[model samples]
Target: METYRGEPAFNLKGLAAMAATLLIWTGFLLSLRSGSQSVLTTTDLALMRFGLPALLFMPLLLLRWPRIRRIRLRHALLLMLGGLPFFYLIALGSHYAPAAHAGALVPGTAPLFVTGLAVVVFGEPLPRQRLVGLGVIVAGVGVLLGSGLVDLASGYWRGHLAFLGASLLWACYTVALRILGIGALEATALLCAGSLAGLLLLLAGGQVDSNLATAGWPLLWPYLLTQGLGAGIVGGFTYGVAIGALGAEKTAALGSITPALAAVAALFLLGEPLSAGGLAGVLTITLGVLLASGLRWPRREVQPAPAREPD
Candidate 1:
């Protein structure tokens, strides 16, 4: 067994957080999927998701405000591509496809996209297994979308493409996260502040409020909880803990279950039916996730540094 400052390496709390991250992601998909069905626009969902949570993170931004000038404006704009852009695009896509599709498309293809980018941009090697996984994923996405292609002129394909775009944004976000090496809270603070700015801009133009008024409070309140509290705050913190404990690769690999989980949730929560192709697509993509994940469970029992009682 591993040790951390002579204590057992098993951190049950961190493990719990990892599981929470998985559940939160699954729920996030469901919430957005369900919420988009309401009168709310993609812009409305984005505002509630980030804007409502702005206060929780805004204080952190103020505390770090003095050092804000040290960061580049260009980098901040790139971060927006990851946060609000990613969220609204998927929310917009969800309006067209079911949560099941968002679950299948977004997380399913993101790593493959990242792997391809890494190979091209950073000279990273594409091992045989990862290459095969990528092929399987391509096939899976084809089968998933294959039936729908016949109706492309009707614009259903646009939603699927939007989800794909969202995945690419996420791949970029993962890349950005690595380059920045910032804390979980710091990244969340920046993303929230940035998204809030965009939301405010839209609000000033009167593009977001009328829809919210018509959507009504009953429908809007739950979305507020799921996007703002659930995904925005809880998902961020738990994923950070999971990454700290399980290593980024393994934790991300474990995210393979998200789509399947989301599919099940959509069935029960939204009564969304899965066609035969959709079912097959889900399994195929899951297989692809396993192959593409580059899974390496840490075997060496290295001693992690002792956990500290904060001063």
Candidate 2:
């Protein structure tokens, strides 16, 4: 496998990891949208989102505590961006907007946010292809948010803004993952543990109430599987693997397809139909992602004729 800085690059394993992350992220959006419609509060959903993974990874986190403690506070906070704060915004957005909007605005705009961060914060040069791709993505996002901007009473605009915020938070997390050079599993453990601790503190302080006890098993089980296990554990780890293998820009760019998948899934499963604007936004964002990811037809590497018998 080709590698950069000890991390795999453009390899099959990373691609597989990204594929898994896509499915899990799609399910995560759907589940969050469903949870919004349920009796569960955003806090309730957040608890489940972080709880199971924290429990499952507690031992691992304990073992790594000494090393984890040495990480700088700012860096640690950045790594935790994918945790509660991110989930809260997503949950809030899901309450107001259909799953399609969340799907479109969050993952779809990630490449723009990530690339901008790279250029501004990391001082990386923006290639012409990536710059053009980002412009396309911005146009797509404008489509998604255009209707919301005019419909203030509907409150969909609030959700759109929250989704954009969540995307930015996720971008921070993605970049931090590359910067910290931590293993995916270890980072997942830390995020879950820290998020759960914060949730528990919130519960203790009466800042948020829990519905886990009253929500009943049927509704809660699906969330436990999708949010707790799938997103909290599986999604986090696979996303990290993707970043490590594909680099942050490529991972986020490829993830742009997530909006379409989630939007379609939401249509079938949740009966959330996409408007014309949503459809246009999804397609434009996807095309831009292909460009931003630099995907191309695989060419057979031509080998030069063997050296002419030392002539």
Candidate 3:
């Protein structure tokens, strides 16, 4: 066990949890990209993303219903930023861009967006290092968008924009979490339940397409495991555990490699080749995330000598 401030910093359990989180996050991008390649629609992917988690969390939602009902509509809407709308953008992005772009743009740039949100919404002061990190992130994103522009016919820029939108929405969700004053599990349940309702409404109105029936079990089971169980349930739980054990700054720093991992995995697993520009973007964004997160090793405190002259 590593200690910080006389308490456990990074223990085996926390490290294991962080590892699980990284795997799930990588799997999430791959799964969404795979679904986009298949007959499944964004609506179908959205269903998989929340359906099982919502079902499993139903009882918990009911238990917390009284408190939940008291929440303001504004906060409720903010919380939903992480739900259907976010997923819809991400799924739409997958249709146009390779998983590598998403790997670079979504999670890679989330901290930048979150920092912007914090400064804007909460009036927090931006530190110089994080400011520089944000600038670097912008440069990296420019490279990514420029890469997409090389083949305008592919319409990859549209996907890149959607991924950025998803990142912003996720940032909003992160800000909302601070003000919402709810446990992680409760928030997850609330968002999933609400998103599930919206999904049903959208389905009923024919606002989105669905291919769950046509896709069959071959497509559906993997999604259920990756989207619902792995990303939705396990990832969130493990992230919370990691945060508790390693603290948020270190956990975020460790998690920043998700884009690089996803990009490499997609190269082999999904047969998506990373262009030089995309590779540069991923590496740059990874460095930016580390800087933006202000990750630093804990320094031992030096104790001052007692007043010997008084004796």
Tens-digit per-residue lDDT, 94-209, candidate 1: 77877777876787677676666566666666678877876777677666655674576657677789989998887766555444545667777888888888888878998666
Could you arrange the candidates by lDDT from highest to lowest? 2, 3, 1
lDDT agreement with native, every candidate: 0.71, 0.84, 0.76
Estimate the TM-score of every prediction: 0.81, 0.92, 0.85
Best candidate, TM-score: 2
- To one decimal, what is the Cα RMSD in angstroms of model 1 from the true structure? 8.3
Q: Model 3, 1-311: lDDT tens per residue?
A: 11112113546676788889989999999999998778888888788788888999999999998988887788789889989999989988988988877877787677677666556655666778878776676676666545464677888988888998998887666556556656678878888889989999999998877888887787689988999999787876686666566544345545656777888899899998777877887778677766765655668799997768854
Better of 2 and 3 by TM-score: 2
Give residue 97's error in model 2 in angstroms.
0.9
Candidate 3 lDDT for residue 114: 64
The C-alpha stretches of model 2 lying farther than 4 A from their native spots are: 1-8, 144-146, 296-300, 307-311
Backbone clash numbers for all candidates listed: 0, 0, 0
| Candidate 3 residue-wise lDDT at 96 | 90
Displacement of the residue 306 alpha carbon in candidate 3, Å? 8.1
